[model samples]
Target: MRISKWGDSLGVRLPKAIVEELRLKPGDEVEIVAATREKLVLQKADDRMTAFTRMAERRLTMPEDYIFDREEANKR
Candidate 1:
């Protein structure tokens, strides 16, 4: 249990082993909620891969080529 000060707030620096166990990083965000007198819930956001894939599947076309005129212009 590493304890450190964050400016004015007394922050608890999570130990390296615990951080690795939780797959947490410096910039990763977590949700903290009071579950009970002793339990504070911390979790990462749900994976959005399925949602994003569905949205991407709905897309009809993707940008590939624009007019194909570059070669002609180069010839000129």
Candidate 2:
């Protein structure tokens, strides 16, 4: 862990490897969530679409074609 003094703010430096592993950039926003008394969650800030995207991805089922069955329509 590296420590640096940035003018008035004291900063703790996170390792580049850890940052890259988390897919975080310098300008990326983060969210700090408090789950338990001792457990604190540090996570990436979620966008409005994050939940929607995951839900859509999870609900995807492809055993058969989802497209219009044009030939079946003509038979009917």
Candidate 3:
């Protein structure tokens, strides 16, 4: 795929075969995974949050009184 200027932003036109194979449309979102300097992989974005909650659920535990200090936090 070649990158071209789209208005002020850069974009690439995916081949018709790959688009059809991935079931991608005009407004579909994809996650770009950069594996190396010359290679970029695209994946359909899943609706899973990959931040703290998922990792915390698997590795971390808390007490029953694990209260969030709302007012203290809001001050920042």
Candidate 4:
């Protein structure tokens, strides 16, 4: 791979082979981690935060005894 100047910062043009190997698509989120001074790793983001936020929008039913510690919590 080769790095090219994009306006100011340098950018690398991912080859078709790499895109297919990593199963990457346009507009997908990726993360870069520096493993060593001469090495870099690229990976897809887990998107856990987005998943948690989506889960938070749903309603969940709790068990009848789920409030067993409510009295203790109220003392705080």
Q: What is the C-alpha lDDT profile of model 2 across 1-76, one tens digit per residue? A: 6568999987777678768877998887777766788654677777746766776789954457556578998999
Better TM-score candidate (1, 3):
3
Worst 10 residues of 2 by lDDT: 60-69
Q: In candidate 1, what are the lDDT values of residues 30-71, reduced to their tens digit?
A: 666448885666665434554657768997443667455688
Which candidate comes out best when scored by lDDT? Answer: 3
Clashing pairs in 1: none
Return the lDDT, model 1, position 67.
Answer: 58
Error of 2 at 40 (Å): 5.8
- TM-score, one value per model: 0.41, 0.43, 0.55, 0.53
List lDDT for all candidates, in order.
0.67, 0.73, 0.79, 0.76
Q: lDDT score, residue 10, model 4? A: 100
Q: Against the hidden true structure, what lDDT does model 4 obtain?
A: 0.76
- Off-target runs (Cα >4 Å) in candidate 2 are 34-40, 47-76
Model 4 per-residue lDDT tens digits across residues 1-76? 8889999899888888878887888887778865788888887666866575666677544465765577898999
In candidate 3, what residue range of length 10 has the lowest lDDT sum?
44-53
> Which candidate's TM-score is highest?
3
**Ten consecutive residues with minimal summed lDDT in candidate 1?**
43-52
TM-score, candidate number 4: 0.53
Assess candidate 1 and give its TM-score to the true structure. 0.41
**Residue 75 in candidate 4 has what lDDT?**
100
For the record, the alpha-carbon RMSD of candidate 1 to the native fold, in angstroms, is 10.1
